[model samples]
Target chain A: MKKRLYIVLFGLAVLIPLGLLSGSPAWGEWDGAYYKKILGFIPKGIQNAKSLNAPLSDYTLGGTNSITGYYLSAFVGIAILFVLFFVLMKIFKARGKSEQSA
Target chain B: MHIPDGYLSPATVVATYAVVAPLWVYGFKKLKASLDEETLPLIGALSAMSFVIMMFNIPIPGGTSGHAVGAALISILFNPWIGFISVSLVLLIQAVVFGDGGISTLAANALSMAFVGSFVGYYSFMMCKKYRAAPFFAGWIALVSSSVLTSIFLGIQPIFWTLDGKPLYFPFGLKVTFVALVGSHMLFFGVVEGIFTALVYSFIKKRQKVVVA
Candidate 1:
């Protein structure tokens, strides 16, 4: 609602779509570069400490990597929507009850 | 479970945050309005319980042994935002400290397990609890539904993202094998999740009655 916040959000909205447009066309040519850096950013050496145990290797089933991470993210979004609605309805019902009691 | 980097597609990563961020913001407001002082502690304790539960991992049928994410149960006790932040933090710890899931896939994992898993399981638990006094059905349904949904989420992981060389052509292909994989685990882990959730819920409910008196 504030001016600066709106400006930042406006910039993100414009940039995200532009990115999607560009990325979609060059999907094949994107050359999996980000994934490597992602793999590197994994704090692996920290594993030696007792605080760390799990390993962060790229998933390789059927002798190759999979591409289904995006779908999972989308599904989570749907679940969040459902929660928002369910809680809102419950609150309205409770408010109605309290008003009636008063 | 935190997904490591490169596991999810860019679309999945960005899209998930887009969806969950709004829901979380909304839930934060709703939770503050609904939960009172006594109820708040129960929610916080349940989250801690969810955190501690993950440490007890069973050896999965496959080579890896994975602990249950406990998102479903958390949602049942508190709300979605609590489940979201709690599990996201769990996934973060798994990624940053433990290196269980890739950094890229971490967001996706949080969304799927916490966002998806929590709501699906919580709603199922509520429905069952409404129709039946027995916590068994509530727990069972919560566990089963979350398992199935999460498996579907996992199955689609290959469809959205691209990681070179490792092309996943699952013979099961999110249909048959995935159902079997997700379903079989629900037999045990689902029940475990449900039982754990129900037990905690019952305990808290009793504790609340005592404190209110």
Candidate 2:
């Protein structure tokens, strides 16, 4: 029952990101160093950096304008959280079992 | 930053290997001591987890996506050295199996991601776990901070202080990309990493389970 709450949290995390991605402006080009179902977010600096060949630090990398990125981030982010919660819960359960047996 | 073979001078490579070899020995010894028979599966699981987690690439604001390197996770599950070994395996797999990184730079990548990233991040995390907020902080700090540190290590030219030569440009395009790549990862991933690591660690702590490693 407790684990379910964690799952719900994970789901919510991903949904917000997906909504943002679906409503973004920069999702047009399928190529030009940013194509495919996976090549998700393109920071403004990174776009310029990749094109201009500037130093990485020279360009600022932020996700303030990224919608798909937020969605993807949330999904994977929450998945990781699920793993954590599951493992911790199992640990707790095992300890309880051990304690009662002892 | 994946340090390709030709980019680093042979001397640099040898020196790096020198620093890395002793740590390898020490980590092996540590593994031998703390690792009990009951934890055999943990080692395998850690290795598998390293291999698997790294493939799930997350797209950044830029068109490219970066995957979690898994050094911190391995360290959380086992001793840092064991995490080091496990991460090395993951790198090797990426190079050979996935064709992601170059084969020549394996040791350097391992040194940064596993040896340095895992141990430093993991130990700091261990210390941080005493407080209620530490779990989230530790996870965020471990992955995000390690991402930056590894980027610097990869980008910084070893010959910055050469006395006889004029300033070499030593263009670090990949290194630069690495920072942007890893830095972005830290900023974005930290929030999730903190939540994930804390909850996961909590689970393991709750179960009295030591990740079989």
Candidate 3:
């Protein structure tokens, strides 16, 4: 089961760049300017809403090559998830020990 | 559907966070109980699978694209709570690091995509376990359920909140949101999710007896 799952993840990782082939955005997940162009005005909240500067905004890195960026983003995302789970595991273990002692 | 930060009203944000806070706390407890040496690697790999699968973003007709969330596979294989927590963590990473979603809308996105998707997929698989296509239907229903909730959140924005004849927040009403978001999912992405879930579930189960390193 583990080996099969790993194979699937690796296969998907290798194919991750295919995700960038379609340049179109998901429905209803568009830019504020899309609202302005279609509805004649951007919604107030959407227009005024403050956005944080994400390190990898829209999954694109510093360079213009999107395929490479998407690949990096996939690896990075996966690594972060694993790291978080490991951290959570450590925290849980520590708390369990404390509770047992109590 | 990853809602951006300002798409929802403040009231909606607060309300969603309030609803998700307790669920997350309880879900974390559930996850802690389930996670052990034997299951940790499997669960982590499944969560990573969910993240990687979402990157596919299959293009559909009508100039929109979406991806099949691998939530159903996890939900059926393990349990709904773990699926929920796993995907919620994925969404959090997307929002904070990739900017795929927004921080403010995290609660709402988690609710629809993680919580609702997991529960719907889990129950659907259980009910249809007699059939080989249970995972397919589970994935289809899970994505559809997530779409329904996301549409509701996006659709209700303009109805309640507005400013001086101009709509505020998400401008689309229930009708448009339901048609565009839900309609697209049911027709295109849902099938992709269904097929992926069914194929992957069977693949994993098939190799269980092999025990290859």
Candidate 4:
């Protein structure tokens, strides 16, 4: 099961660039200008929306090819998830040991 | 649906965070109790799959496109709590790292996509376990259900948070949001989620004597 799951993950990651085929954003997840064009005015909240500066905004590095950035994003995301789980496992194991000892 | 910042009113954000806070606490406890060396790799791989799968944006007939959540497969294989936490983590990464979602609306996004999607998919699979296409139906209905909640969240903003006869937030009514978000999910993304769930579920369970929760 583990091996098969990894295979599936790798296969999907390899095809990650296909996701960029659609230039259209998801419904309701549109730019503020979309509302301006459709409703003749941009909503106040949307216009003044505050968001953090993401390092890899839209999953692309500055000046890099989109496909390369996408592949890097996939692998980086997968690596972070794995490392997170590994750290979680260690914490749980240590807690279990402490509880048993106490 | 990855609701962006400012799509929801402040009141809505506070309300959604209140509703999901306890659920996240309980879900985290459940995850801690279940994580171990034996299951760590499997769960990690599954979560990675969820992240990778979301990258595949399939365009429908309309100009807009959406992707599957992959929560159904995790929900049926383990438990809803595990599925919820796993996907919530994925969403967190997307928001903070990739700017795919919003920080203010994280709780709302997690509630709709992770909590609702996982539980609905899990229960749907359980109910239809006797049938061969149970996973497919579960994934389909789960995604559609999540979209319904998302539509409601986005739809209500215009109705209640408007000023000077102009919507202050999402700027769309229930009718429009329902027709767009829910309608698209029901027609296209839901089908993709169903197929992905069915294929992955069968592959993971094939020729294996593994015990599932």
Better of 2 and 4 by TM-score: 4
TM-score of each: 0.55, 0.57, 0.97, 0.96
By summed lDDT, the worst window of 10 consecutive residues in model 1 chain A runs over A21-30
Candidate 2 local lDDT, B1-213, one digit each (tens): 334333343444566677777877777556554444345446545554454444334555755444455567567656677788667655654554333443445666678767766776587777966778665666666666656645554445433522234212122344564657466756665566566556665665655544433
- Residue A48 CA displacement from its true place in model 4, Å: 1.0
DockQ, ranked from best to worst: 3, 4, 1, 2
lDDT tens readout by residue for model 3, A1-102: 788889999999998888887888999889987997899988888998888889988898996689888988999999998888888888898899999999
The fraction of correct interface contacts reproduced by each prediction comes to: 0.06, 0.00, 0.82, 0.85
TM-score of chain A of each: 0.37, 0.38, 0.96, 0.91
By summed lDDT, the worst window of 10 consecutive residues in model 2 chain B runs over B161-170
Q: Chain B alone: TM-score in each candidate?
A: 0.73, 0.76, 0.96, 0.97
Per-model tally of clashing residue pairs: 19, 21, 0, 0
* Alpha-carbon shift of residue A83 in model 4 (angstroms): 1.3
Q: Write the per-residue lDDT of candidate 2 for residues A6-95, one digit (tens) a residue.
A: 343344443453333322111121232432233343223223221222111111124444554444443443344335434534565566
Any runs in candidate 3 off by more than 4 Å, and if so which? Answer: B209-213
Better of 1 and 4 by DockQ: 4
How many angstroms is residue A24 displaced in model 4 relative to the true structure, after the best TM-score fit?
0.7
* Better lDDT candidate (1, 3): 3
Task: Please give the range of 10 consecutive residues that has the lowest summed lDDT in model 3 chain A.
Answer: A63-72
The weakest ten consecutive residues by lDDT in model 3 chain B span B204-213
Which number leads on DockQ? 3
lDDT of 1 by residue, A1-102 (tens): 123222322342233222212112110111234333534332221221232333322111233323332222222322343344355446766786898899
TM-score, chain A, candidate 3: 0.96
lDDT of each: 0.49, 0.51, 0.91, 0.91
What tens-digit string does per-residue lDDT give for candidate 4 at B43-150? Answer: 898899889888888888878999999998899988899999999999999999999999999999999999999999999999999999999999999999999999
**Which predicted model would earn the best TM-score?**
3
lDDT of 1 at A83: 49
